[model samples]
Target: MPPMPARIIHTSIARDWREVYAFMADHEKMPLWASGLSAGLTREGEEWLAPGPLGNARVRFSPDNDYGVVDHLVTLADGQQVHNALRVVPNGDGAEVMFTLLRLPGMSDAQFAEDAAWVEKDLASLKSILESSKA
Candidate 1:
């Protein structure tokens, strides 16, 4: 299969990389910044169930680690799994958070652009929340 087009949407935060990672590593806190999970997530065993575009979706997050990685796989109702790659790394005294978005099969140019814009907006939301919070 051919590689899908990808976009690395990111934002800079005026906070320590470790601090940013710590805040984002908590799955339950996603709803605070992630509009996609604005309806919130419910933990069921190891996976989390969140309201999807179509229906409830199961989300499996990457295990905790010293390195900053907040990857997750969202399983849609139709069993389509979308893998989201997120990372936090040092940017001088601040931090840089990045999210990789892929243009899936059958997606149109307009749809892909919209998805990228959504990711950019979400990252901005995250930056706002973290930057405004007390360290």
Candidate 2:
């Protein structure tokens, strides 16, 4: 069988890179950008809990860093661990946010495309919020 593909979705945010990264890294602000985390998050020990299709799942975000990397590992209620890749990079005076979506083993092309579209919409939401706040 062919391997699952890794796809990236990105958007230009009209905010300072540092500001964008800081907001993106904060779990509390995720509901403002990431729909998958819309139900909100709470930290417990080393992990964070959020609502998803699998119910309340434990997520451990990578420790804060200076290089703009914002990766996270989500542990599903049923024991599946999914690694989600995300990043923010400087773009002139603003920033560009990118989200990497992985196509799981059993997912079909259609399903993968759907996920990609979802990421695009989520990024747009992020862009809208960050950019509008500056206006």
Candidate 3:
């Protein structure tokens, strides 16, 4: 399967950039936005665990505030591995989030597409939460 390219999602929230960034970076708050996610980061050294309704997996994230990027590795429960990257850029009134979910050697394209769609919906929920909180 071909590696999935970065999917960009943009939205305007009433909250400030700092608040928006903080909300996104807070792992514990993921289930509040992400669908079917039961818990957030479970760290073991540099690696972090992300558990959802599907299964539990480990990933490593290196945050670069200067470049507004996070380098990560997404390892499937069955031993498949994919290198992922996320970049958050400040827009005119809000922020644009880009997620690059690379295709692993044995990963199916259909699964990747499904996951991408879920992520898109998650971001939309996040935008709504942030915008509504400001009102």
Candidate 4:
């Protein structure tokens, strides 16, 4: 059988999927929660340049969709592309947001685990931000 994604991290946000998707679907807003892009983003057409620990990197986020898909591909200064598969699904009155993290080449097992934790933290931040905004 084909291998599954190395890891899938997720969280259920208190806000409706519409609200969650409206926030997450904006690629330019990613740095607010995404640790890797703490310095935020600048865009030109389909390409987005986000400041990274190493340097500025280019990215391409999937176009907004009615179904709440928020995937993206990031290209570092070294020209390596990393695909991040993310989705938001309705769960009752709230939303379930999931992130699929793949094990890339040269990543150690521990590094993969750490990446999952990082995703969890980021998702939690997203949850906090969205839920708080309603206050």
Tell me the spans in candidate 3 whose CA falls farther than 4 Å from its real position. 1-14, 52-55, 103-112
Writing each residue's lDDT as its tens digit, candidate 1 over 1-135 gives: 699999989899999999999999988899988889989999999999999679999999999988899999999999998999999999999999999999999999999999998889888988998899863
RMSD of each: 1.0, 1.9, 3.3, 2.0
Clashing pairs in 2: none
What digit string (tens of lDDT, one per residue) describes model 3 on residues 1-135?
A: 554455554455556665676776665675688664457677788777888565888877666366556556768787777675666677766666666655445557787678777767777898888888852
Model 1 spans > 4 angstroms off? none
TM-scores for all predictions: 0.96, 0.92, 0.71, 0.92
lDDT of 4: 0.87
Candidates 2 and 4, the one with greater lDDT? 2
Worst 10 residues of 3 by lDDT: 1-10
Q: Extract clashing residue pairs from model 1.
A: none
lDDT of 2: 0.88
Best by lDDT: 1
By lDDT, rank the candidates, best first. 1, 2, 4, 3
Per-residue lDDT tens digits for candidate 4, residues 1-135, read: 355457789999988899899989777678898887888899878899987778778889888799989998989989888888999999999999999999887788899899999999999999989988862
**TM-score, prediction 3:** 0.71
